[model samples]
Target: MRIAKVEAFWLRCPIPEAKQHRSDYGLLTAFDMTLVVITTESGLQGFGEAKAAVGSSGVCASIVSCVENELAPILIGQDARNINELWERMYNGVRDHYAIKRGRVFPILGNRGLTVSAMSGVDMALWDILGKSLNVPVVQLLGGAIRDRMEAYASGGWAGADAIGEQLLGYTAKGFKAIKMRVGVMDETVDYSIERVKAAREALGPDIKIMADAHGTFSVPEAKRFCRGVEDCNLYWMEEPISPDNKKGTAEVRAMTTIPIAAGESEFTRFNIRELIELSAVDVIQPDSAIMGGITESWRVAALAAAYQLELAPHCWGSALSFMAGVNIAFASPSAVVIEFSSGGNPMMYDLVEEQIQAVDGQILAPTDPGLGMTVNWDFVKEYKQ
Candidate 1:
C-alpha cells in the first residue's frame, strides 16, 4: 500500500480543575496536541502526536499543514513499507543547506525544531502503520522485548520537600525502589537542593535509589556544588545539570560529581547523541521519544549508548501518547535503567490514556498489544481537539 494522505489535528481539550498538577504542561488549562493521521491507499491509517505547547493549537495546525502540504506530496506515491528509507529521504528532503549551516533554519523546512517535531510525528505514525500491517507490536519490529517490565522512578516532587517526600514514600510503599525529583528549581541554592535530596533519602531510606533533574536550570558553579553536596545521597543520576547543548558545562558537572550525569531530552537526532556519548558528557542518556525523533531515532540513540556502555533512561514529559512511545523503546532497550513517569501529578495523562500506567509497587508492566500497545481515547482526543 502507498501513503495516500496525511492529516493533522490541533486539539485543545479542557482538563478538569481538580486534576491539574503544577507541572501539567497544560492539563489544568486547555492544552493543545498535534495529532497526525496518515492514510494509506488500502485505507489503513495510523496516528501520532507532536510536541505542541499548551494552547498552541495553531502551532499544531501549522505542523499538520507542513506535513500535508509539504511532506505528504513527497511520500504519497512512495511505497509505505520502506519505513527507514522513507525516514532518511524525509530527513534529507528538509535538511537543506540552511539547516546544515545555521542549524535552526532549513530551506524546505522553515524551523528546524518544529520540522523535526513534525517529522517525528510522521515517522512514529509510519512505524505504527508498519507494525499494524505486520500484525505485530512496535517492539517486535525492533527485535522483540528483552524485559517484561521497566523500573519506574517517581518523577515529580513538585509540591515541595514535604509533599515530594510523601510522594517518594508512596512509591516506595508501592514497591518502587527508585524515584526522580526535579531540582535546580529550588531557589538555586545548593543547600536547598541538597536538603530536598536528603529529605527524599531520609523518607525512602538507604536501599531505595533517588535521582534529581536540574532541568537545565543550573549555573555551572551551582551544579558542581549541588552535585558534590548530593554525592552522599547516592543519587542514581543527576539529570540535565546544565543546559542540554552545553557540552562543556555538562562535562564539568560530570567531572565534579561522582554522581552520574544524565541528559539528552532537549537534544535531537543520533548526531547529538553520538557527540554526547563520545564526549562522555553525561553518565546516562535521556532521549525523549517525542522530542528526539520519535521511536525511529531514539532506538538509534539507545544503540549508540549501548555501544558506549552508557545508560539509556528516556526523558518522558508529554501526554500518554509520548509515554507509551517511550515504553516501546524501553521494552526493546537493553541498557535502559528506568522509564521516567512525569510525576508532574497531572490527570491529562490518566484522562488521555484508557490504560492507566501505574507502577505496581515500583515497576511498570510492558504493554502487550501491537504498535504502542495502549489505545488512545479518541473521544478524549475529540474533546481535547482544538
Candidate 2:
C-alpha cells in the first residue's frame, strides 16, 4: 500500500502553573507539540509527535511547514512499506542536497534543528504504520525487548530547593529511585547549582540517584566547575552540562569530573551520535525518538552506543506518542539503563494519550500492544490544537 495523506497538527499546550515550568533555556510559557499522522491507502492511521525544545515557537512552526511543504510532497505516493527509502529521502532532502547548492559556500544554518524535527515526526508515523501493517509491537519488530519492564527516572527537579525537596519526596513516594532536576536555570553560578544538587541529595538521601541537567547553558569552564562542585552529591549522571556542539569542551568536562555526562537529545542523526560516542563526549547516550529520527534512527543510535559500551537512556520530552516510541527503544536495548518519565511541567504529556505509563516499584511497564501502542486522545487534540 502507498502512503496517502500526511497531516501535521500544532498543539500549544499550556503549563498548569506559569512559574513551575521555567528552565535554563527559558520559561516554558506554553509547550508546542507538532503531531504527525500518516494515513495509508487502506485507511490505517499512524501517529507521531515532535519533541521540540520548550518555548520554541519558530522551530515548531518550521516542523509543521517542513512536513507539509517539504516532506509530505516527497513522502506521499511513496511505498508505505519502504521505511528505509523514506528516511533516506528525508535525510538527504534536508541535510544533504538542499543544504549544499552549487554556488553556496556553506550549508544551511539550522537545517539540523528545523528540518530534522519534521523528518523525525514523519519517521515515527511511518514506523507506526509499519508496525500496524504487520500485527506486532514496534519493539518486537525491532527483534523483541531486551527488557520486559523498563526502569525510569522521575523527570522533574525544577523551581528551587524547597520545591525540589517536595517534588523529590513525591517522586520517591511514587517509587521512583532515580530523578533528574534542572541546575543552570535559576543561577549560572556553580555555587548555586551546587546548592541545588546538595539540597536534592539531602532530600532524596544517598540511596536514591539524582541526575542534574544544565540544559546546555554553561560554558566549558563553568560546566566543569559546576560538575566538580556537585561531585560530592554522588549523582547518578549529569546531563548536557555544556552545549552539545562543543565536543572537545564536553570531553574536557568529562575528563575533569567523575560524574557520567549525558547528552544528544538535540542531535537528530546517527552520525552526530557516533561522533559523540567516538569523542567520548557522553558516557550515557540520550537520543530522543521524536527529535532523533524516531525508532529507526534511535535504534541505530542504540546499536552505536552498544558497540561503544555506552549507556542509552532515550530522551523523552514530547507527547505520549513519543514517550511510547522511546519505551520501544528502551525495551529493545540491553544498554538502556533508564527512560525519562515527565512530571510537573508537561501538561500535553498527561493529556495526549488514552493511558499514560507510570512507574510501579521503581520500574515502568512498557506498552506490549501492536504498533507504538499510542492511543491518542483526539478530544484533547482538538481542544489544544494550535
Worst 10 residues of 2 by lDDT: 98-107
Task: Give the per-residue lDDT of model 2 (tens digit) for 246-316.
Answer: 98889888988999999988786787888887788889998888888778889999999888999999888
Once model 2 is optimally superposed onto the true structure by TM-score, how far is the C-alpha of residue 95 displaced, in angstroms? 11
lDDT tens digits by residue: candidate 1, 232-336 = 888888888887768877887788778998888888788788778777787799887766777888899989888888888887666676777787888888888
Candidate 1 backbone clash number: 11
What is the Cα-based lDDT of residue 239 in candidate 1? 83
For each candidate, give its TM-score against the true structure: 0.89, 0.92
Prediction-by-prediction clash tally: 11, 0
Compared to the true structure, candidate 2 yields what TM-score?
0.92
Best by TM-score: 2
Give the Cα-based TM-score of candidate 1 against the true structure.
0.89
